[model samples]
Target: MKTCLPFFLTISLLIPAPASSAFYQWTDAKGVVHMTDDAHKVPKQYKGKATRIEVKEPARLPEAAPPEPGPAADLAAPAAGRGEASVPGGHDETWWRAQFGELRSELKTLQAARSQKEQKLVELRRRRAIFQRSRDRAAINEAEAQASADDARIGDLLNRIAALDLAASKAGVPAEWRQ
Candidate 1:
């Protein structure tokens, strides 16, 4: 039994252990992405869209190697230390999302509002011009006030957008994401 125990130990040491984890990805109805290790946990409706992601075994290295030099490579240095990929300015994907996600949503809504106001503003300007030529004091004042209010509102929206842009630029956010 002692000799058999040694042989079994040797066999166990020689054999590789099977992988114990897996990952699956799916997007929900609200467009939020989800990831889980258990396939059975996913909803029945999402099963068709769920994708199995094979987790590759990390290569066993004797020593750490130096990263290559480049824009992305330079950025990867911080990401490596943080155990994740980052953008140019040492900010990871989650960080960027935290910073810009709500701003992006607000920006979209504001831009739409600005577009509608702009059209109304143009019409107001034309009406204001007509009122000016007619030289009617009360009508002219009302037209001018309406036009000014619209102009001021439009300016405010533009300044807010510009501020968002400036903040993104300072953070080294990508141009595509600035919108």
Candidate 2:
């Protein structure tokens, strides 16, 4: 009995479990079994024994609505009129007025910004001029000092040559031929 029990356990473990599907297997009136996705296909005799398989459907989302008109559309209509505008074009007065207000605000901002930039540019130009003058003065001073130093060096070299000639004369050497 114990050996038979092991065989039965192995056989049960080897058999695969039923797969998940939308179909079901049922036996018809003739006792022939068949698989089908539709429950109505099962014969009346197998309906009682047929197993039901559940199917999950994807969720559907609602569509979006069209956009509404802007504030300008409201402004073009006359005060007394309910649907159409009192004006000839039936345009919304509110929308035009809103646009005009936006333009005026933009113009004011631009004017303010322009004034600020102009003031900044003027100060920068003034500072640049001051810097240029300073730079020019420094260059002139440098050039003058360089010229004075060159003159001093030349004078020193002439004095050295004169001293050498004097020494050659005192030593009884021909100073003119002292190459």
lDDT of each: 0.54, 0.46
- 14, model 2: CA deviation in Å? 99
Candidate 1 colliding pairs: none
TM-score of candidate 2 on Cα atoms, chains taken together: 0.28
**Best candidate according to TM-score:** 1
Global local distance difference test of model 1: 0.54
As a whole number from 0 to 100, the lDDT of residue 162 in candidate 2 is 41
- Mind giving the per-residue lDDT tens digits that candidate 2 earns over 1-179? 98999999999999987443355555566867687888888778776555433333322222221112344445544443565534222223354344345444543454344444444444555665677777555555555454344333333333333443343344343322344
